[model samples]
Target chain A: MKNLARYIITRLLLTIPMVFILLSIVFVVLRVMPGDPVSSMLGGHAPERVIEQKKEELGLNRPLSIQYLDYLWQICRLDLGESMVFKQRVTKAIAEKLPATIELTIFGILITLFLGVFLGAYAADRRRTVQDYVIRLYGIVVYCIPVYWMGLMLQLIFGIWLDILPISGRTSPRVFASTFEKTGLYIIDTILVRDFSALGDVLIHLVLPAFTLGLVLSGIFVRLTRANMLDVLRADYIIAAEARGIRHKKIVYKHALKNAFIPILTMMGLQIALLMAGAVLTETTFSWPGMGRLLLERIYLRDYPTIQGVIIMIALIVAMASLVVDIIYAIVDPRVRY
Target chain B: MATILEIEDLSVHFPIHIGTVRAVEDVSLNLEEGEVMGLVGESGCGKTTLGFSILRLLRPPGRIVKGRILYHGQDIVQMSEKEILSLRGRKIAMIFQDPLTSLNPLFRIDQQFIETLLTHEKGLHKRAAFTRAGNMLESLGISPERLLEYPHQMSGGMRQRIMIGMGLILSPDLLIADEPTTSLDVIVEAQFLDLLNDLRKQFNLTIILITHNLGNVAQLADRITVMYGGTIAEVGEANAIFDNPLHPYTQGLLSSIPNIKLDKPKLKTMPGSPPDLVNPPSGCVFHPRCPYAKDICKVQKPETFSKDGRLVSCWLYG
Candidate 1:
């Protein structure tokens, strides 16, 4: 336990500088880019006095070094400033929207995990058979189609054609609950109050968007799980396990599956970062208010503060997730610890 | 005194795209309980194939085409998957060729050993299983604390000992050691073989030692079988076989061993390469390389006949 604590502490200490460099680079690059943020947010034809006043207000009129120092200071203190597009404090904006994006990502990942691991384990159990072929074929078909197109198609089929689910937004219109409610995420608010009808409506609304997002990830997870499981099967200990007459399912799950998932956990963490990056497409298609779709809109409007804020936020999330993965890896296999 | 394993008319054929290769052709052997039999053959002479055949670990493309591998009195070939599995680690376990690759590198020693124990002893409590495993490790002259380490942390000899420990822990009726010391250095190899011999006697274990080293057989085996080109060239009590090898191939093999004669020239080697399994020479498999080859030797395969209380597959004995 002491060794694990030391290892984690060492890794955390090393990450401090890396986080600083990452945030610094994003902040400086956004500042250096040739854009009049004030004009872009308000109007390109705004008067010079008004533009100058906006620049001073945003601290853009200061020297580069001063601006960098101020940026670093704000970052160190966790004062992320305000969103240019929304005219809201950055922390407030994130607190409101972050939960929705996080919830969606979590649901999508859970779906991927449950289905992907099941399929992979099943395929390995029936290796080289028709069941294996069919599972692999299904993964390939789902993987190749674009997530946005899948979302639209699902919306068209399930929502528009069948009238089984909502087409857009988070909840049903009859709920009459104002969108101003600060539950941050609609699904959680409904579930917390034991509102089954509202929860069902939220799930029905979530299906098209979450499926669209999860389909590609599910394919990747299945492929990774299958590969790792196959590798574990070929491991000498597994052969030893078989030679010992341990029941087949026990061999598959206890011996093969858990060992197989060690590497997959690391991959899953990386995939989380990739999924967040890809969620831009899903959020745009579904009109789900999340960092990704917000990033694209902010980029178009030249809302430099919002774009920079979101990019920095993503970089930090990715770094943190990767750090968690390394910790989990050491926990899973103590041999990995130095 | 009682038969433990009996192999009769065993032939393992490997099918290639071009043609089928007979890896082990009509080889037969018998083992009594608490006996150590050494299978001595040059490389590629099907020693390992025979070993895998006993374990039924021969995978696709290579198969036991015709054989009765009778463990106790029941034919293993007729056993179902579940029945075979039940017998595998409990009755017949194999210590593989390479100790390093034979262990799972990703697992700790405790995990591997405890799992091995549990796999064989179903419903065994985890604490009791680990205790037995630790005891087994200690009995193998390993520190019980080493169980916390990984395979990569141990030396080759240590890993080999662990493999032996794992095989012996179950107290199986037959233990197949397939060139278990081939990957170790000379000192480690000799130590490992000695350790194996000691463990066998201590556990009253039945051992089938497979190796290319004739010297290994001379050291430990009660009986030795010399295989050449997928067939047993000779079989006898170790002392008699070493002293009076009857077959030409066996004579060549024994004579190839360096003697301490100052005046003697370099040891003589068998002149030709091993016959290709895909298209083996007719009659005696060793005919092309046998100095005493005759017309009948090229046309007729010799039958096993007894001479001096030993079996020799040669025309002279026939």
Candidate 2:
């Protein structure tokens, strides 16, 4: 237990420099680009004097060093300045959009865990047979597909072609007005208010997008888990368990799957980082009002403050997710703490 | 004594890409009730495969092509999967080579033991099962408190003793141990053998001890079966095999055992490697390595020649 505390403390301290490095990169990369928010907002039609006055007001007329120091100071204070596009606080804009992206990733990952592990364990149990071959081929094929293309195809089929599910947006405007906004997530909000109709609408809208993201992510998990489970199933302990005449199901699920999932948990953390970055393509395609779509609009409007806020937020999330995975791994296998 | 295990013409094969790797072929042995039968052989001689075959635990592409593992009058090789499962752990239990790898690393010793006991005997509550498991371990000289610890937390000898305790929890009719002492030091090995001797007498257990060490066999075996190239080279009393080895392979193995009393500069090694199971030699699998190989030894497989309860498969004896 003392070892775990020390391990966690060391990791937490280490992330400080990592987050600083990421912040420096985000600040420099945004400034390196040749664009100004004032001109982009005015679209090159404004007078030079008016632009100069606007730049002065926004504190962009200051030297680069002063700007950078000031930016760092504001970041330390959790003040990300204001978004030029939304004309609101950058932190507030992100806080609103953050929940939607998180919700999607959560649902997508849940689906991935269930389907991937199930299929992988099944394939291993039926190894060397036709069913095993077929499942493996399917895993490889899906793994080769690009997520954006898959997401678009899902939209085309489930949205435009079949027209059973919504093509875009989080929910109908009626539910937006009627549902209580306790959690910012409409589904959760609806449940909190016991509003079934709004929940149905939100869930229907979530299906195509979540299904598309989940299916793409599941390919990786299927192959990883199948390989790991195969290795675990052949382990001497599993054979010993079989010799003890324990039921085959108990051996697979209890012994083999438990051992196999350690690596999977670590991989899931890495995939969470990927999912945060990948959500830009997914959220934009679905017209979901998430941080990724906000990022796109802010980029077009040269809203550097919002972009910086979003990027820093993402990097921090990735780092924290990895930290959580390490903790989980230590807990699962006590040898790791030592 | 009546026979506890009767292996008749047992041949276990592995269907590799090239062809069948005949890991264990044309082997026959009989284990009398309450006797310790030591199966001695070098690595890849199919001793472990033969042991696994008794419990029907051979995974593909390794399979029993032809065999009769008769317990009493019932052929276990022909028994249904469910019937075999019932027999395993309850009637015939086995201890593996590496105790570290043979227990689930994720679970505690108590959990593993309780699960094994409850698996064969259902409707048994977890607490009662744990008590029985603890008693089993305590009987094997391991403390009951150690049951809650993980396999990694224990020393190698402790884990091995726990495994032995687990194998005898239900008082099995027969116990098959495959190189149980290979991973232990010489001192630990001797202690384990002593424990096994005491346990056997206490439980009235019949045992099949599979190993390459002649010393281990000399310590505990009532009889011995020598295997080479995946087939039986000789089968006889421990005293007879040690004193007057019949087959050339047995002679070579006995000669290879190093003697500390003599100032022998080099330990003897058999001239050639064991034959490849996939494409073994035309006649005797040992003919290529046997100094006694002749025209008949290279052309025709020899039949077993028996005399006074001893058997040897060699043309010289035939």
TM-score of chain A of each: 0.89, 0.94
- Location of the lowest summed lDDT over 10 successive residues in candidate 1 chain A: A175-184
Which residue pairs come into collision in candidate 2? Answer: none
The TM-score obtained by model 2 is 0.97
> What TM value does model 1 have?
0.89
Clash list (residue pairs), candidate 1: none
Q: On residues B118-163, what C-alpha lDDT tens digit does candidate 2 reach at each position?
A: 9888899999999998888878888899889889999888888988
Runs in model 1 lying further than 4 Å from the true structure: A1-7, A13-36, A43-70, A121-126, A161-167, A175-192, B106-114, B143-153, B259-267, B296-300
lDDT of 2 by residue, A251-282 (tens): 99889999999999989988987787667878
Docking class of 1: acceptable
Cα lDDT tens digits for candidate 1, A178-297: 533447677767767777787787788788778878887888778888888988887766766666556778888877887888888988888877788667888888888787777787
Instruction: Give per-residue lDDT, candidate 2, residue B74.
Output: 92
